[model samples]
Target: MPVNYTEDAFNGLIIDTNTIPTDSVEFGASLTNILAYSAENNKGITWLTLPIEKSHHVGRATALGFIYHCCQAHELTLVHKNQPAQFVPFIPSHTVGAGALIKNSAGEILVVQEYGMTGYKLPGGHVEQGERIEDAVLREVLEETGIKCEFVSVLGFSNKHPYKFGKSNLYFICELRPLHNHIQILDTQEILDARWISLADFQRDAKNSAYNHELFSALFNLSGLQPQALENNKGAHKKLEIFFANHKDGLL
Candidate 1:
């Protein structure tokens, strides 16, 4: 089931190849070389190239589908030519990461400030090689916030920014219940400060805080859970129920 991109599939999407202004023209040349190299190394494999219009909107999906199909079919390369052709190397794998959407008894959201990163973010980190995503999230939350948590429900998945370390296509969003008192917060070097902010406060500060806004946006869309204002701090446990009720249909 090698996925091939047909011209008709990219009929009305926008892909501005001209926006990639590189002097060396290395992208296209490098892509070409990779395809050739892959073909020579993998016997019985053939590369397919398709011209993608500059105005295609689903480039990422298309590219993903192309790679998935090529890998499934044991093909070596699938190339896309816009103003310049780009070759995507295929590597099929999965990685685990954890995220916690924690709330206090008052229904306020729990957020932590990283030592060097501006703005408060939800407590989370990568799941180590032998750890489960939920367990990793609970450990990270405890280590970063000093609070043991009961895993409640999964929110959904997200694909993060591609970087040199590698690309993670899935992130688990979990609802958690704190099992300890909120004493004087102990700052882990991993975090400089932590607090529980009301959803109202989160909304008010989101526009002004880059970190708040980015995190909120990711959390909001990642689970497709409707944002709700908690009625009282006593009802923080209910917030997870609301989120799960609204988004359970799509949870992973």
Candidate 2:
């Protein structure tokens, strides 16, 4: 059977690697046919996704001019530009992280200190692939501080460049209500300590970062963004979480 593939809006083709033959010889022939077809049709680019089992074929594809694009889980995606100047592939440029600013009934805030952290910070971490921002913060809180919390709203976010891998970073501080007040450190390696501190003490403590203190203040003084329900008619994409002004009175 001919190599299974689909055309992209940019007149590019995305090859179905599952249809590729595992045999080296057959793989080469199939790749050649695809490339020839792409060139004749003036395709802008071609994307090839290879599963972990086909790692041996990576070198072969690279030798044919495929460049590493990105990787996830057990698969690696490579790209070849048929018309280099016509189409530019999108590169991942930023990392998204969520911090849980959790406060309990006792007016105490949840905090954690990572191994290298000089001051206590919120319990949080990077969002996982295909995970929602709200879910990410909740998971991070549980992972870092063994706390179960309810996501309230996003208090604020910080943006910075020159982060890991030269990519920009966006860190969102989310206000959360603690459902379980007890604190336990699940992973001792990443977390040095986890505990509850009075909000007053947190604001006055010299060991606490100013950034965290400001985030807490925002929770009480500012109306942070609230997640709004969104509907997607295009069934191809995943569910999206949209944040907008949480004003009770509608914005004119």
Candidate 3:
């Protein structure tokens, strides 16, 4: 009997594919239907994740050929993930991280470059258990930059998908004002160098790579600091222009 499938239900189709006998004819038909219906109906599933069933030597590689065919024949963008690179006996869930967005009196943004990494990053680290997000941000900033700073306001956080190590990270960005203006590495164990960069320079570096581009964009969006912080907010970085008739701080 040909398997019946719901119009747009994943469990009704994909999930059932796993339990079906791989040696049986139903397996091929089910997988074919999944690819065909996904291509035609725009099911919008990017990852065609099939269970790692070792019973019949079923692997993601087996599906790759069909996925390639789906792209060539039906013009679909699909990939598969199963039997991870290295099977971890056990792994943890998403991690919570906190970073600070601080500017110097000269309006330079603070960034840190790790030992083995290219380009600079905001001062941040994983939030330990029982630590408040605000506290974590302050601790990480001080540890990485060795600059004591006072928290101004809660900026926001970035939620990243699992890219490497099967671990996603939630990074909280907070507005901080430096109490002490000095760059000393308190945590040499983690960070190699720390420096303050001009906002313009930071923006260019962020947009340089796809990873940094998305990261910085997410940071600005999460912070909601300024309307001009979005991805389209390009062009030469301009100085602040406070327009007021009477209220003049005389500081740009």
Work out the TM-score per prediction. 0.47, 0.60, 0.47
lDDT of 1 by residue, 1-252 (tens): 112221221221222234422322443443344444444543222234333432132343244333322323222224333323332333446556778888767777777787666567778876766566667888888877787888766776577657312445467778787876473345464578777887668767743377556566565524334334456735535433233345455533
Residue-by-residue lDDT tens digits, candidate 2, 1-252: 666888864578999877977887778778888988999998878889899998888988998888898887788888888756743434477888898877677777788998877789888988866679999999889888887888778888899898853579888988888888888888676799998888788889887789778767667545568887666624667456878775468551
On TM-score, the leading prediction is: 2
Overall lDDT per candidate, in order of appearance: 0.54, 0.80, 0.58
Where is the poorest 10-residue window by lDDT in model 3?
Answer: 82-91
**Deviating ranges (above 4 Å) for candidate 3:** 1-92, 163-168, 204-252
TM-score of 2: 0.60
The best candidate by lDDT is 2
lDDT of 3 by residue, 1-252 (tens): 443444322211233333545454566666565556656654433233333442342443265432321222222222432222311112246767777878888878788887767778788877776566667788889889889997655566678988333568777677788997799999885687899877567677643456665555555433233212244445687432211222245332
List clash counts for every candidate, in order. Answer: 12, 0, 0
TM-score order of candidates, top first? 2, 3, 1
Model 1 alpha-carbon drift over 4 Å, by segment? 1-94, 183-187, 206-252
Q: What does the lDDT come to for candidate 2?
A: 0.80
